[model samples]
Target: MARLRDLAKLIRTKNAGPFLLTLDIMFPDRRTYDRVVASGVIKKESMARFFSVDESKVRLFNYEPANAIKVTVPRLVTSGDPADTDLFGGQQFGPLVNVEVPDLPAA
Candidate 1:
């Protein structure tokens, strides 16, 4: 029942563009990376719910070389729009910091 933050080396968010926000979940090593990806712990459905975005619009990428997962989604509002709150998107990653990760059954 370990949390995602405890296993991830880095989980951060940033602005990909005026209309997109990007999230990065990096693992410290391959073992940890495999655990999250193989277990289906970080699926688009779950992520969509977490971010309040449409599943079809969410883009998830796993980079083996970096042992990292990247998620890109349209921002709630265009950057610098009247409704925009976080211009830098730097503080948006906090919600992912304590997400509980379910343990995969013995494989």
Candidate 2:
């Protein structure tokens, strides 16, 4: 939890635009998972569904509940020519890069 908060602060300081953090957990008990979800520390859209195949093992996407974090940063786009403004109107645009961190166990 503390780590997550620190990460959030770091992200804010970086001033990166349009980022996503995904946390993945493996085979966690229902109660523990629910409690973590209830914390509201993660965004709703970042929550991934969980599937339990056995009492000891469960699988979920890299999301808050799963303990995996993903950070997405937009890529910089440059115009073909400095004098040509038609392509970008004197600006450049590009898509964002998706960064996926490894999974972490429940704390």
Q: Which candidate number has the best lDDT? A: 1
Clashing pairs in 1: none
lDDT of 1 by residue, 25-104 (tens): 99999988988898777889888888899999999999999999999988888889888889988788897877777776
- Alpha-carbon shift of residue 81 in model 2 (angstroms): 22
Whole-model lDDT, model 2: 0.30
- Predictions in order: lDDT: 0.88, 0.30
Global Cα lDDT for candidate 1 = 0.88
TM-score of 2: 0.23
Encode model 2's per-residue lDDT on 4-77: one tens digit a residue. Answer: 33222122112122221212232234443344445543333333211112322222333545434332222222
